[model samples]
Target chain A: MEHRIESGADALYMDERDHVATALRDMKAGETVQYRNAEGLRAVTVVDDIPFGHKVAVVAVEEGADVRKYGEVIGRAVVSITVGQHVHVHNIEGIRGRGDLGSKEAAAQ
Target chain B: MMNGTFMGYQRANGDIGIRNHLLIIPTVICSNQVCNRIMQMVPGGVAIPHQHGCSQIGADKDRTFDVLAGTGKNPNVGAVIIISLGCEVVDPAALAEEIRKTGKPVEFFDIQSVGGSVKAISHGAELAKRMMADLEKQEKVPVPWNKLKVGVKCGGSDATSGLSSNPALGAAADSLIAEGGSIVIGETTEIIGAEHLLAERCVTPEVSNQLYHIVNRFEDEVQRMGADMRGGNPSPGNIAGGLSTIEEKSLGCISKCGKAPIQGVIEYAENIPDHGLYFMDSPGNDIECVSGMAAGGAHIVCFTTGRGTPTGAAVIPVIKITGNKMTFRNMEDNMDVDVSDMLDGTGSLEQAGDRIWQEIKEVAEGKWTKAEVLGHQEFSINRIGPSL
Candidate 1:
């Protein structure tokens, strides 16, 4: 959002949660660009690029703040995220999804 | 803008509507046939044959209740006559109460109350005639553009949809929003992977979260069905039209909402209270989805399609826009706006937006949408249940 580098015919889309994402890069184009994700301010570089319109784990989640991508709860970050970093299931985990038949039962317990 | 007009009925609830319709609402499936027969006897009434109203429980039951209430409350309806079987799980009185709150005259007759079908049909027609007569005396005031709440939707999508028709409609949506009008967008399942793009534009964190929740809810439901959404969410039709994945399909689907601040999310059939850009949690089922938006109070719907559709709401004017040259050419009779020039590179997005905006004014002023002129009174409310 700060600066636009060159995507080279590649389009970038924010995930459901607006963390730092590589959500939708052109898959077949091999055409890619880089951006500052929890790393350098005004950063522009390609790190974990994928196909056209593929998902990329986001970085830069703050404490207790939900990650935004794919317009849904992909996961919640356990710790803080810096700009220009990669966020995956490793740091972000389920908060609204069913790993246990939902936590309303756990809440009751 | 547009200086067009259509024959519409004015309602006491302070709503301007394009249709003066007597709707026969069946409280239960057992009464659907009776309702249909009543519609057959009446010249200007409409009937919805639904699978709900009985044999549903829990959220399924609640969904049916919402839809029933929503349908009866659509502003296009001048009057409503509920056809009931007397003892259904969803109460006809409660449904009638919801509709009556809109200040329209409503009458209900149970087939059991009249000893069967023939008597119910006879009674329903008579009530419809009286209601229609009362509605005829109403008049239309020059309602502002802001008073219009139109639903934005796309179906039978193609790649050109994202590049042309969808963005054009989105521009029109932005124009409408700028004019203080309301725009509602649905098809939650179609927006699976693209929810974040919309979330970033949310007016508030709460609205952002609602956008997140629906996408998550849809993903969970698809998972529960044990079939990958990648299978059907994009549909073979969509794939043939060039959308590659559910994510890709969704990326294009969200464009219809335009660049407006997200206000909030509403339940599938919940009333669209003073709309800005409202997202309704609904499936991509064309008939049911359009039905849901209609019931929720969209006076009109601007549906963009790349593959083409003949679907129309029973009451509201459904204006169809397409960017596919072949589809537009082949299905010329069904389409309202052929924005294929955008694909041909002969038309710019702003030009298409102006044209559609002009069409909107014309439609609002009472120009019959192609669907209306073709008598495409297609009506289907999402039936969230199994048959007994």
Candidate 2:
């Protein structure tokens, strides 16, 4: 997917499949930020303050659903996330390299 | 724009060196002081004082010896002086002999043989002075890009790392490979979740299997400890910078190597091939990883970071590039290049990549990186087992 540069974009999404866009600057709650994705320039009014270098959901995600970034699964959503809400450890859980989960799977097997 | 050729020192073993270093190696931790003393006495002398070399057995001992010997044999080093503290698991003679095979001058002795630390320091200082004199006389000639081997690495990463600096460095890596040069990517732990992506890019089935093997081995080791890699991996700092999972971090981390097809996988500190892109099995710890690359014969390392790191190697130059503008503005003394403008829609990826490519050429031709100028000679070796 192409990342076309749109002047004055407040955030950037790497691929068309990415569910979240990364904040280019600290954004306030209830603020509308513009970002460029494969679909071109789009706007999202954030429900939560997003810090610079942090991720903000560009599309809504249901709990336990895979979150894609760079056109790959980054993690699974731990809670239902709304569009424009902050997306990070608070709302998502990493599924790989979880030795805590590996032992549990071993016991179940 | 500068030409494609870089002015570099021609080594006796047909290797090209960007820096002609007079390297002083301490064969054992016990000899660190003497080695450091000699470094102080002899101008232009660089010493690597590491913790291993004593009470290590089997592969562990061999790894320490290999890393030390490899660092000495690095083309960047013009000559070497090895100091040992009489009795250590690492044999000083064998270490010197290994480096001598490179056709470079090597001198070695033990503190016991030279009376003590004071006498050894004096003797080592004398030897280093003479070697430094000879190294100063070597001339640098025009060398093509194919003669260089560059290592791409990322540490203290944040969200912007994958988006900007890392991929930009990847472009630079690809540019070097296009010139028939070599690029080595490591930090096997960081690539755990993203190994499958890299595997698909391997040139052969065997190379892909090796990639998976290393990833599986690391995961099994982590599982053996019954501990999660979360807190340790998407490190507290990484989390603070918005990297939530190892998968996300790994995906971002691998982008620094560009899109080159993987040619082969080599053990840590093993000699990197003369050309093509290779992967070295190594740890994610900043100093240990960079040290391994240096030992593997990397002439220079291009390190990308979101949170700034002041890591450098004993004999090789580390070019620090950052994607976080604040981190760059705050740590300007430690940072060499800033590509954060790409995140702000102010700079294109090609411009960022070209900026790094220009920096690589400049550093290759004798320009000092901020790490080198600030004297950040950080080095560490990855161990397989406990010290005996």
Candidate 3:
């Protein structure tokens, strides 16, 4: 599987199924960025400045829904995430195989 | 079979070593000072001084013995000089006997038997100097890539780790495995959130069970210690480097193993089996993981770091890779390969992998890694149980 962007795309979607695309370079607010996925090439307008190597949600994710990257569920979004928004620790929670998530789950409820 | 070969020292047991080193081992923490002194006195001598060896019980004591013996037994080590504190739980004679199985020269002495610290250092240094001279005269012979066993590891990870360097390293690992070589991936703690992915790749049901067993066992130990792995993992540096979750970090961590079927699961510091890929139950801590791989008989280790680390081993060489352009530029002295081009769209992952594969060959041909050139011989053995 190839992972390089020959078309000068500013972001990368690891798989067509991945809901989040990682920023290959920093993008200013309102900048339109191109990303390639399994489906085809697509564009998203950055609502927030995305730094290098950080994830930007390519698809809108509802609160408590899984945030998929590399075609796998990395975590669940803590708040409703819109497309082009910066996705990081502030808005997502790690829930996979955790032993101490009861308090976090309770807080979410 | 893999094409091309590098100049190496082929051992009597048929294992090929990239380097011929004189190893000095301390059976107890009490012997660490004397071992270090002896190593210093002898040119080209390396010593691994650890803090365990007395009042250790059961598995802990066995682990120490295994690591020390394994280090002495590594193919890179041409000869060994063992130093004991005269009275420690780890038996130097038995340890030397274990290493002698490889048919390498081994010598042992305890402070009590040798009179005192002064006499012990003098005796150990003399033995080490001779061993070093003997190893210096050993000629390098052509050894195929298939004879190589490399441990794949990542530390100080960030988002680019999974996206670039780790996956590029994975490609390189696959290339080696395709040629009948063996690749080892460890760090059970780092694979916490995404172990199921690896478990699914096991070649057999038994191997899958062992994979799950070790992951579960580590989680159980963490729970017993009244701590959760997610709290400390992904580490602070990882988070600062833009990793938000343990799941995110782990998903990236496993990429360094390439896309190989998990052949078997081995205990920490156990001898790595020949051929294909094996998973060792080891910590994600950089030095401890590298040490386990070296003790497991790895000829070389490929280490990926996003934030940068200058860790090397006492015996084998550690090739450092980074996927962060900034980290690479900032820590140019510490890093070797820069796959950051994958992130910048200047290079493909395959090309980056090929770059690393070339580095491995050159290193096997006697090229020094940045850590080796900088003389960073960091070594640490993973310890279990308490010291009494």
Best by DockQ: 2
Model 2 docking grade:
medium
Model 3, stretches more than 4 Å misplaced?
Answer: A1-3, A102-109, B2-4
TM-score of chain B of each: 0.95, 0.98, 0.98
Q: Where is model 1 more than 4 Å wrong at Cα?
A: A1-109, B1-9, B383-388
CA lDDT, candidate 1, residue B139: 79
Q: Model 2, stretches more than 4 Å misplaced?
A: A1-4, A104-109, B1-4
**On residues A3-109, what C-alpha lDDT tens digit does candidate 2 reach at each position?**
32567788878889889998888999999999986667899999998888899999999998999888899888989999999999999887777777666355223
Against the reference, the lDDT scores of all candidates come to 0.72, 0.90, 0.88
Per residue, candidate 3 scores C-alpha lDDT tens digits across B1-388 of 5555778898988888998889999999898899989888887899899988899999999998999999998999999999998789999889999999999999998998898899999888888877888888889988877888999999989888988899999999998898888999999988877899999999999999999899878866765555445547878788777788877888898989999899999999999988899999998888999999999999899999989988889999999999999999999999999998887778998999999988987898899999999988888989988988
Q: Residue A37 in model 2: shift from native, Å? A: 2.5
Deviation of model 2 at B89, angstroms: 0.8
Residue by residue across B264-314, what tens digits does model 2's lDDT show?
Answer: 999999999987899999999999998999999999999999988888899
Which 10-residue window of candidate 2 chain B scores lowest in summed lDDT?
B1-10
Better of 1 and 3 by lDDT: 3
Which DockQ-derived CAPRI band holds candidate 1? Answer: incorrect
lDDT of each residue in B1-388, candidate 1, tens digit only: 4232234555678776766678888988899888888788777788887877877787888788788778778887888888889888888888889899989888887999898888887888788778767776777655556667889999888666765688889988998888777899998887766778888988899989988988877767655664545437567777555454555567767777789888888989888867489998888888889999988988899999888889888778899999777788999899989876764446777788778888987887778898988878776767556655
Q: Taking the tens digit of each residue's C-alpha lDDT, what string does model 1 give over A4-45?
A: 222322333333345544422333322334433333323233
Tell me model 1's lDDT, rounded to 2 decimals. 0.72
